[model samples]
Target: MNIKVFIYDDNLSRRDSLKALLELSPELEFAGEAINCSAAVQDMETCFPDVVLMDINMPVVDGIEGLKTIKQNFPHIKVLMQTVFDDSDKIFECIKNGASGYILKKDPPQRILQAIQEVYEGGAVMNPSIALKVLEYFKPQEQKSPLSEREQQVLQLLAQGLSYKMVADKLFLSFHTVNSHAKRIYEKLHVSSLGEAIAYYYKNLHQ
Candidate 1:
């Protein structure tokens, strides 16, 4: 099925470009577009889009605030942030506010489309630099993970780019046991993916 996409951006040119791109991509459908997200909930409800491409800077209500509102009202709809700014603080804020993905505005059109598809398929997407920043941003926080020691060990291995099988072998555990530990770690960390769990662990590792 084609992914229904809505756009929220203050720049007329950007909006037009996005609309044109959607028109050309067979996998994507243009649901709607808005200049800003002052009435994000209303606009989103009207469109009922599967994904929203949101710009960070806007008049009155910025993308971060708009993202919060949209998530609050329509938690099922995925929101991907598109912005020229790559500030760590803003990126973290958007994630905490429930944004599904973050892509730089300077990214190629194909990358943006891939991000939308990734988010729609229940995967989180971010620029490689953004991912590193996310990991670095949490390096100084106190550890607050509720995972057991075994789970922590598994997660640590996972964070070091180990595959599940590799982690299991290193820890002298069965594959099922390793998978179980990873699942528990995700639950305790309130994250959905290994990347997010690693980010959370780094943030609270000092504790």
Candidate 2:
């Protein structure tokens, strides 16, 4: 099946240009176009495009709000934010609001095509700078574990980044017992990642 796409941008020239570039792919079909947020939403209902290429700045509602609206109303239609702004907050907010992908307006046409494909395949895309921003934002906020004394020993050895086998050997515990303790540690801490567990340990140092 052809990948149907809708373009939402106030600039007629940009919208047409994007359409022309994407038309090069036999697998992609231009479904429709909308100049502003309201029209975009209406067009989405009408066209039901599989993916939407949306600009950040529009005449009335702007891209972010339009993205939020589209995602809210048409949850299955993935919106790929096509904008000039590399601002971290904008990217983060877009993702938080259900944007499936983000790409700079200045990116090569090829990259935009790839982004659409990625979003269609259930993947999230973001500019490299935007990715770094997310990492920075989450780095400090990542959760840490609160293991008990014995659990802490198990985790500390694990934090040394030891493998389960090594931790089991060093702690002189059966591998099965060590695995059970690790599972409990993960549950008590409410953490899924080792980095979060490590950060948790430092945050509650007084404990």
Q: lDDT: which candidate is best?
A: 1
21-49: candidate 1 lDDT, tens digit per residue = 99999999999988888889889878889
Q: Point out the worst 10-residue segment of candidate 1 by lDDT.
A: 138-147
What's the TM-score of every candidate structure?
0.67, 0.67
lDDT of 2 by residue, 1-207 (tens): 989999989898998899898789888899998888877667887898999998988887888888888888889999999888788878888888999988888888888888988999899998787778788888866445456777888877777779889988998988998888888887888988777766766666435
RMSD for each model, in Å, please?
A: 14.7, 10.4
Stretches of candidate 1 off by over 4 Å are: 140-207
Clashing pairs in 2: 144-200
Residue 122, model 2: lDDT of 95
